[model samples]
Structure formats: C-alpha cells, structure tokens
Target chain A: MLLIRAIVRPEKKDEVLAELSSAGFNAATMVDVVGRGKQKGIRIGGMVYDEIPKTLILMVIPDDAKETVITMILSIAKTGTGGTFGDGKIFVSPVDEVYTISKGTAGL
Target chain B: MKEIMAVVRMKKTGATKKALVAAGVAGFTAVKVMGRGNLVTDPKAIEACKEKLLSMGMDEFSESWDTEKMVTSFLDGSRFFPRRLFTILVHDDDVPRVIEAIVTANKTEYGIGDGTIFVLPVSDAVRVRTGEAGEAAIW
Candidate 1:
C-alpha cells in the first residue's frame, strides 16, 4: 500500500475530494492545516502572513493505483494555466500495514 | 528523501521555523495537534488542568476545595496538550541538520515534554505543476 498526502489550498479541497470519490477512491482523511511552500506564504498589504491555511488530504491506495489517484488530485487541485505557487505538493510513502478496526480484518 | 516530523511545544513554533530556515530548509507543513507524553502525573499537567477548570467557571472550587485532587480527577478525562507538528521533507544528507535545528529550538531544561522527532522514509515526491518526480520534484 502507498500513503498519499496532498496539501492543497482550502478552496480546492472539495473539488479534489469529489473527484477522488467519483474515481472510486473514497476513503480519505482531511485535516485543516497551516503551511507554506517555496513561495513561503503570501504577503498582503504591508504584512507577511507566513502561515497559509490549507487542507491536507490523506489516502491509502493499492500500489498500482498511485498514478491514477495522483493524477486526479493534480488535475483538480491545480490553479490557473501552468499552475501557480501554493497549488500544493503531494508526498507518497510506503504503508506497511492496514487494518479495518470495525471488521477486524486486515488490508485495504 | 526523508520526511522529518517534529512535534514541538506550541510556543516554540516560531523559533523552530527560524531554525529550519537557517538550516536551509525550503518549505514545511505544520498542523495543530493534541498529544500526551509518558509522564501522566507531571505537576505542570495538573496545574494546566486546574487553570482550565478555573477558566470554565469552576473558580468556586479553587478557594475552598482541594484543587489538586479535583485537577487530578479531571486529568483522567483530559490528558492531551496542544502541540505543533511540523512536517518537513529534506534530502537524505540534510536529515541530521534538520533534526538538530528542531531539537535546538524546542528543547528545554525541564526535558520532559520537549516533543519528538520522527524521520520516515518517503517513497517518492511529485511536483504537481511541472510533473517532476523524486529529487527533481522535491526542491
């Protein structure tokens, strides 16, 4: 299994989630977080707000399904032509084990 | 690549960020989280509970009642404390530097709830805009 963590703008969270659900990858955990990327947060007026609100979406999928899920998220989360800063980045990690708490069954 | 996750005191987030930047880290993600360490009966923990109860209209108990006992009873109900979890991804060579920076900024003389640093192995990373992967994507 692979764990995909996508940090996207709050405005695009719903769209990304909906897209993933439509694609049959429904199980996901979303957390509201504050972070920054290469842009190092945005500056408005005379102040620099270093912490930007974002939605972190986490999902665990079969290894083979990684590309499809990532593509779906990227397509839905990107902003404007060629994408702008804060469009978000995705990190993929290996998941050694998964268990269904209610069913008492293992694997996803 | 490695993912360095550091859970530090809420008040030390600013110092941690500055330390990471000074250590040459480009970007990071931070989330507000609530967690508890092994020291369940720490005095500071009990004091925090008392303060919380007093703030929530339990001032009557503060003067006449055994506040410590009340706080200790409440401890079983609420043991978690607020913390900041910083998730930073850095190249393999930079792991030690990042770890050092986080520790330097968060460590205190008390040494109990200084927080934890976890270094996890990242399989891959992707930059959504340019379709880059691996090291090319992580910069």
Candidate 2:
C-alpha cells in the first residue's frame, strides 16, 4: 500500500472529493490545513496572507492505484483548466505495513 | 526513520497518545478527520440515493458540488465516520516498538473500530530549530 497526501485549495475540495468518489476511490481522510508552495503565500492589495486554508486529503491505497488517483486529483483540483500555482501537491510514500485495529490483525 | 500514521476512532486518541509518549516516541501530530472504508462505497447505489435526496428539495447541493459529498454524506446523518489521524516519525529501529505500543493502545476485545496504523519510509528529515537534518534533525 501507498499513502497519498494531497494538499489542495479549500474551494476545490468538493470537486476533488466528488471526482475521487466517482472514480471508485471514496476512502480518504480530510483535514483542514494551511500551507504555501513555491508561490510563498500570496500578496493581495499590499496584504500578505501567509497562511492559506487548504484541505489535506489522505488515502492509503493499493500501489497500483497511485498513478490513476494522482491523475484524477490533479485534473479536478487544479485552479484552472491549464492549472496554476497553489493548486496543491501530492506526496506519495511507500507503506511497509498496515494493521486493521478492528480485526486485531496486521499486514492487511 | 519511518513515518507512522494511524487513523483511529476519535475516542482512542487520548489513549493512543499516552501509549506512544510512554513508549518514548519523540513527537506526533493528530488531526480530526472524516472518513470511511471501501466496503461501504457503492457508486451506483450512492448515485441513486443522492438523486432521491435532491428530488425531495434537499439543499445538499451548493454552487460547487461533487461526488465526494454523495459518498461522504450517504446517510444524511453520520455519513462519514469521525476519526483521529496520528502521524509520528521515529527512527527505523523503533518501528516495532512504536507499532507495539499503538497496537496495544488501540486493541479492543470486541474490535469494532480499532483503527489502522501505517508505517512508511522516510527518505530524509530536517529539524529547523537546530539546523539539523537526517537522523539528528528528527530528534
């Protein structure tokens, strides 16, 4: 399994979640977060907004679904048709083990 | 070091933290989240339910809406289960100890929503407080 963490805009969250669900990938954990990427936050009308509200969607999925899921998120989470800054980022990490608490079992 | 992230029942948060802290795991971040398992995800069935709800003049749909809302709000009430996600990073050797602590903390005899723990490899880590990176940074 692999864990895919996507940091995306708050406004784009609904779409991202919907698309994922439609694509048959509904299992995700979401948290409200604030972050900035290469843009280094945003400056509007001489005001600097250092912290931006973004939703962190986390999913522990089978390794094979990584690419498909990432692509789906990218397509739906982008700010515009061609994409723009602050659209969000996806981090993929290899999972060594998974334990199901309900079953008292490990490696599932 | 490895990043150990666990999504557990909301009620288990306190106990899980105490166990990890007692185990000497350095630090962790816990976030409240809404989630569900794949077992409850049936797209076709969910769509039909969504349409039914909408036809009844339910304002569930806002200007911006997507399928996620349908899946997450399938039951109208308690559609998505509440969970607490704990993220901990520890040295590679400490993985077993940490997992043991978490399992012990989360284990329930009845085992309804014990939660799940995931162990992932960390290529590198950097601690900003002391300008440390790699193993030292994690400390």
Candidate 3:
C-alpha cells in the first residue's frame, strides 16, 4: 500500500476533497495547517506575515492506484499558467503496514 | 488569541502513539486522508483533480499530495470548516501547549515516520452538524 500526502491552498481544499470522493476513493482524512514555502513564504503589502495557511490531506491506496491519485491531486491543484508559488505540493511514499482494526486485518 | 495547526507524516503505527505521549498531546482527534506527490511537473494532474471536483458538483481547485503518510491535528477551532474535515478548538490557554506538542512530535528525528508540521491561526468555528458553540463545534 502507498500513503499519499498533500498540502494545498486553504481555498482549494474543498474542491480537492470533493474530487477525491467522487473518484470512488473514499476513506481519507484532512486537517488545517499553517507554514511557509522554502522561500520562507511570500511578502505582500509589507505585512511580513511569516506563516501562511494551508490544508493537509492524506490517503492510503494500493500501489496500482498511486498514479490515479497523484494525477487527481495535480489536476485539481494547479495553476493555468504552468503553476506558481503556494500552488500546492503532492508527495508519495510507501507504507510499511496498515492495520485494519475493524476488519481485524492487522497483518496487512 | 493564536491558533495552531500541525501536519505530520509518520508510518501509521504505535510509534505515532508513542510520539504523541512523549509530546503530551495523547488526546487529539485524528482523521484519515490520502494522496501523493506528482514530482514530474505534470500541470494537468492538479487540474485533473479539479475536473474531478467539477464533475462532482464542486468548485474546481488545484492541490498536491507529497510522498508520505500525513496525520494532522487541529488544536484551535476554526471557521470555514466543512463536512469530513476534522477540526479541533482549544481555549486560548491551550494553544501554546498543543502547538508545542505538535512541533515536538513532528521533528524528523522523532516521528518514526518521515513527518512534517504546520500551524495556522483561526477566527471562529461552527458545527453545522448541530450548531454547537465554541470548542464543542470543533471537537
């Protein structure tokens, strides 16, 4: 199984979730977050606001489904002109194990 | 008042529990989420997800999922929260402690799984499910 993690603009979170849900890939989780890009975030109006709000979404899926999910996130989280800062980021990795507490599939 | 939020990537297991206990925030509400990183610079990918959203009768928006399992806990209540979005609201006094716990647990050396953390301020929170007030709506 693979675990997919996504950090997206706060405003786009709902669109991402609704898209993921309609794709028939339910059973995921989401939370609100705050942070800055490696550039230490952006500067606007001389406010010097260090932290920017973001939405963190996570999900678990089979290896074969990885590309589907990745494509889904990118498709929903990109800008029309190539892309820009704070556009969002998606990361994919392997899961050592997944415990099915309800189904009692602890071995998985 | 300050609001804090955290996102951590950890191998889903007892290690997460241990890290939480060590950080002294063993009592956080957790929800599951999923996705992955499209490092290939595929501009259509995020849009594809947006199209998926549009098909579902939702606004089209872009997003990204990095490579790792991310678990996030919202310590302070926040408005604009929608269904299936896990939220938590803490009093002004608890913000610092929760933030500290999240930061400590998210460190690269501590999380057992590759972890990341982030914090954000909140204005208010409302529970559409029952119209609860204050932290009740978030918790």
Candidate 4:
C-alpha cells in the first residue's frame, strides 16, 4: 500500500473531500496543521503570516492506483486558474503492512 | 525504524499512552480526527439519506441540505463518531513491543472497530534541537 498525505489550504478541504468521495475514495483521515513551504507562508499588505492554517488529508491506497489518486488530488487541490506556491504539497510513501485490530487480519 | 500510525477510539487514548510509555516507547504524536472508512457515499446512498432526513421532518433547508457537504457531514460527523490518530516512530526492533502495548491498552479482543494500526517504512528522521538523524533522532 502507498500512503498519500496532502497538505492543502483550509478552505479547499471540503471541495477536495467531495471530489475524492465522488471518485470512490471515501476512506481517509483529516487533520488541521500549520506549516510553510518554499514561499515561507503568505504576506498580505505588510504583515507576514509565517504560519498558515492548513488541512492534511491522509489515505492509504493500493499501490497500483497511486498515480490516479495523486492526479485527482492535484487537479482538485490547485488554488486558481493555474497554480501558486503554498497550494500545499503531497507526500507519498510506502506502507509495509496494515492490521485491522478488530478483525485480527493483516495486509489490509 | 518504522512509523506506526494508529487510528483508534478516542476513549482508548489514555490507556494506550500509558501502555506505550510503560513499554519504554519515547514519543508519539496524537491528533483528534474524524475518520470515515469504506462507508458508501455514492450518489444513490446520499439520495437515500436525504430522503430519510426529509421523512424525519428535517426539510427546513431543503435545497441547501441536499448538497454533498451535508451528505458528507452526515456520513462522518464527529457528533456521531470521533477518533484519535497516533503516530509513533520507533526503531525496527521495537515495533512488536509498541504494537503489543497499543493493542493491550485498546483491549481489541473485545470487539470490532477497535481501530487499525499501519506500519510504515521510514527512510529517515531528524531531531532539530540536537541535529541528530536516523534512529538516534527518534530517542
């Protein structure tokens, strides 16, 4: 399995969730986080907001479907017409095993 | 080292923490989250739920409440179910001990939904304060 972690703008969370659900990817965990990217956060007027509020949506999907899922997320998670910094990032990593405590089963 | 990420019932957190600490596991990050696992959210499912809601005399926001947001919330609202996510990064040799601690604390033998534990491969870890990396950074 492959774990996909995406950090996105807070406001884009719902849209991302909705799109994912429609695409038949319903299992996920959501968390609120704060971080900065290459841009080092947002600067509006004169004040620099070094820490920005972001939502992290995490899911572990089958290895074969990695590209499709990532593409879907990137397509929906973009800020505007094209794209810009702090639009957030997606990290992909391999999951060695998954155990369902209730079922006492592994490789799930 | 491996990163053990578990999404378990919120009520089980305290015991799980105590167990891990007692087992000599150094640290973990815990976050409160709403998790939806394999729940059917197809259009048909949403429509049926909307109808059920309407039948229950919840027709005030007829149009607005029929949205995907409403259906999604209905499916995974915290008011109905809230869970805790715990991510523990530990040395490879310590994996079994940590897993045992979590399972024992959770008492998963009792029933289902005790939650899931995912073992992920970690390439490296870094400790900012001391500039340590790899297994040493975790401790």
Candidate 5:
C-alpha cells in the first residue's frame, strides 16, 4: 500500500475531493493546517502572513493506483492558466499496514 | 528520500521548530492532534504513576491508588492529550540529523509521553508548479 498526502489551497479542496470520489477513491481524511512552501508565505499590502491556511488530504491506496490518483489531484488542484507558486505539493510514502475498526479486520 | 514524522508535546513545538531550522531543515508541516499512549492500560505504567505520586508527597492518593478507577476515567476521554505532529521530508543522508534535532528538543525527564518518531521511505515527491521531481523537487 502507498500513502498519498496532498497539501492544497483551501479553495481547491472540494474540487479535488469531488474528483477523487468520482474516480472511485471514496476513503480519505482531510485536515485543516497552516504551513508555508518554498516561497515562504504570502505578503498582502504591508502585512506578511508566515503561515497560510491549507487543506491536507490523506489517502491510502493500492500501489498500482498511485500514478492515476496523483495525476487526478495535480490536474484538479493547480490554479491559474499555467500554475502558480502555491499550487501545492504531493508526497508519496510506503504504508505497511491498515486496519478497519468496526469490522475488526485488516487490509484495505 | 525519507519522511520523518514526529509527534511531540504541544508546548515543545516552538523549540522543535528552532531545532529543525538550526539543523538546516528547510520546511515541514505540523498539525494539532489528540492521542493517548499505553499509560492507562499498562500495569508497569500504573506502578510508575504510584511511585511518582508518593514522591510528590501525595501519600493518600498513592496508597489508595485504584487501578479500576484510573482506567475508567481515562477511557472516558480524560486521557487524550494535545500534541503536534510534524511531517518533515529530507534527503536520505539528512535523516539522522533531523531525528537527532527532534529528539533533543522533545525529550523530557519523565520520558513517557515525549512522543514517537517514524521514518518512512518516500517513493517520490513533486513540485506542482515547476514540475520538478525527486531531489530537484525537495531541496
């Protein structure tokens, strides 16, 4: 199994989630977080906000489905004509185990 | 590349951040989380608690230490403590330094719930706007 964690702008969260759901990935956990990327945080007017609000979407999927899901999120989460600095980043890591609480069973 | 996850006490987050930066780490993400350790269910933990209480001069409470009451109260949700989960991505070689920094900042004398650190292999990383991959994407 593989764990995909995508940090995207809050405004694009729903669109990304909806697209993933339609693509048959129904299980995901989302958290509201404050972070900054390589560009640091944004500066508006004379104010500089070091931590910007973003949504973190976590999903555990089969190894084979990694590319498909990543591509889906990349396409839906990007902003503007080409892409902007805060388009967001994705991190892929390995998953050793998973368990279902109510069923008391293991595996996805 | 490797992803280093550290769950530390909430109050220690600032010290952790400074430690990471001083260790040359570029960036990381942190989220507030609520969790509990095995303290409530472990017999050894209960004994340790009793010892600490006695050392603090709470002789009555320590002498009357009721395991059943303690377990019930903890299970009722009073056991959950706030923590900060930091997700850090670093080059393979930087793993030790990052882990060292996190441990130094979070470790306490009590050492029970200081938290846990996990190192997972990262398959890949991508910079969305620039389309950079691997090391190019991370640094």
Candidate 6:
C-alpha cells in the first residue's frame, strides 16, 4: 500500500476533501502545521516575511491507486483564487500494513 | 499519565486496536487527510488554476460557507485515495518508546519510511464533562 501525504492551502481544504470523498477514496489523517519554503514564506504589502500555516492531510492508498489519487489531489488543489498558497500537496510512500479497528480487516 | 504510549498500525486492525488499548489511550481523535510535497509560487500559475476550477463549476463561495460538510461528503464517497491519520492522547513520556516500537516493527529507515511519528508539546487540556484541568485534562 502507498501512504499519501498532502500539504495544501487551508482555504481549499474542503474542495480537496470533498473531491476525494466523492471519488470514493475516503479515510485519512489531518493536522495543522507551520512551515516555510524557498520563497522563504510570504510577503504582503507592508509585511516582510513569515512562516505559513498549513494543514497536513495523510492517507494510505493501494499501490495501484497512486496515480489516480495524485491526479485527484492536484486537480482539487491547483493554485489560484480557487486554491491559494498551500492549496495542497501529496507524498506517497510504502505502507507495509494497515488495520482498521471497528472492523478487523488487514491489508487492503 | 503513564510512561509508555503509542500509535501503531498493523495489517489487522484488531492488532492495532489491541495495541492502542494495551497502551492505555482513553479515547482518540482523527480527521481524514491528503498532501503532496511539491510547492510553488507564481501569480500567473495560481490564477490559471483558479480559472480552471471555475470552469468546472466549483463555486468557491459555497464551499467557504460550509467546508465540514464538503469534506465529509467527499471523503465518504472517494476511493483509492491518500493517507489516513489518528491522533491519540497518550502519556507524554511514552512518545520515544512508542516511536521505537513502530519503527522496528515496521522496518522503516531513519528519516525515510512508509509512515512517520510526530510529537507536539501539549499546551493545556480540558475535560468536557466536568471542565477539569491539568493532568486531569488527559483522562
């Protein structure tokens, strides 16, 4: 299985989540975080630079589903008026195993 | 607060549940999540993306008004998607040992792996039922 990690714009979070759910790919983890990039953060009219507030969403998908999930995330998190900075990002890694508690199921 | 606490994953959700139970977490909170590491900065690019979304009929205003509803609706319906998360309130001291257990058991390398563990400094906590405080906050 592949574990997907995405950092996205807080504003567009709903769109991404909704799209993912509608696509039938729910089940993931999320948190709020602070980070800076090469642009070194952001600058407004009067402000200099500062760290950004981002929401980190994580999930594990079957290996065969990587491309589809990636595409969905990108489509939902594209930058702009629709998705601002930190719209969303995805990271895929190997998930050796997964176990959901309410129902005792192993692997995907 | 006990000395050892952990968040573990197993092929058998039963095992993971058993582990958490054995670890002694009273209750846990989790939210669905997703992400990509690649980030960028370009006004034109951002604008174009917004235009594309607009064309698709994703009304920004409606989403802004009610994101929780949107997220739940989307996640419940999607498939073959991204990562999942679980946040457990454990005895703070257990953080290190639990990390050890998960890494060794999962066979993940340092700074690289299928999954990771992160720690956050607990500022303060509260008990919803009685409005308790401090260590009492954890229970």
- DockQ value for model 6: 0.06
Cα lDDT of all candidates, in order? Answer: 0.72, 0.78, 0.52, 0.79, 0.73, 0.53
Top DockQ prediction, candidate number: 4
Clashing pairs in 1: none
> Which portions of model 6 show Cα errors greater than 4 Å?
A81-88, B1-139
**Candidate 5 residue spans exceeding 4 A from truth:** A1-108, B39-78
Off by over 4 Å in 3: B1-139
Query: Each predicted model: what fraction of the native A–B Cα contacts (within 8 Å) does it retain?
Result: 0.01, 0.91, 0.04, 0.81, 0.04, 0.10
TM-scores, one per candidate: 0.49, 0.74, 0.45, 0.76, 0.49, 0.46
Better of 1 and 4 by lDDT: 4
- For residue A1, model 4's alpha carbon misses the true position, in angstroms, by 1.0
Considering only N, C-alpha and C atoms within 3 Å, which residue pairs clash in candidate 5? none
Report backbone clashes per prediction: 0, 2, 41, 0, 0, 46
TM-score of chain B of each: 0.77, 0.69, 0.37, 0.68, 0.75, 0.48
Residue B18, candidate 3: alpha-carbon lDDT = 63
Interface RMSD of every predicted model, in angstroms: 12.2, 2.9, 14.1, 2.9, 10.4, 13.2
Q: Write the per-residue lDDT of candidate 2 for residues B1-139, one digit (tens) a residue.
A: 8888898878888899899889997589988887765543335534565576656544555532545465346543223578898989899899888888888888876434466788888899988887789999776
Write the residue-wise lDDT of candidate 4 on B39-113 in tens digits. 542555356555675566445566654654565566442122578999999989998888877877786543445
- Residue-level lDDT tens digits of model 6 in A65-97: 889889888887887657555454576656443
Candidate 3, residues A1-108, lDDT tens digits: the string is 766778998788878777876676654556677788877877788876668898887676778988888898888888776877887788776654343321222222
DockQ of every candidate: 0.04, 0.56, 0.04, 0.59, 0.05, 0.06
Whichever of 4 and 6 has more DockQ, that candidate is: 4
Clashes of 1: 0
lDDT of 3 by residue, B20-100 (tens): 566454445555433221122333423443445444543234222311111111111111222221123455666555545
Candidate 1 deviant stretches above 4 angstroms: A1-108, B40-66, B70-78
| RMSD, one per candidate, in order | 12.3, 6.9, 17.5, 5.4, 11.8, 15.6
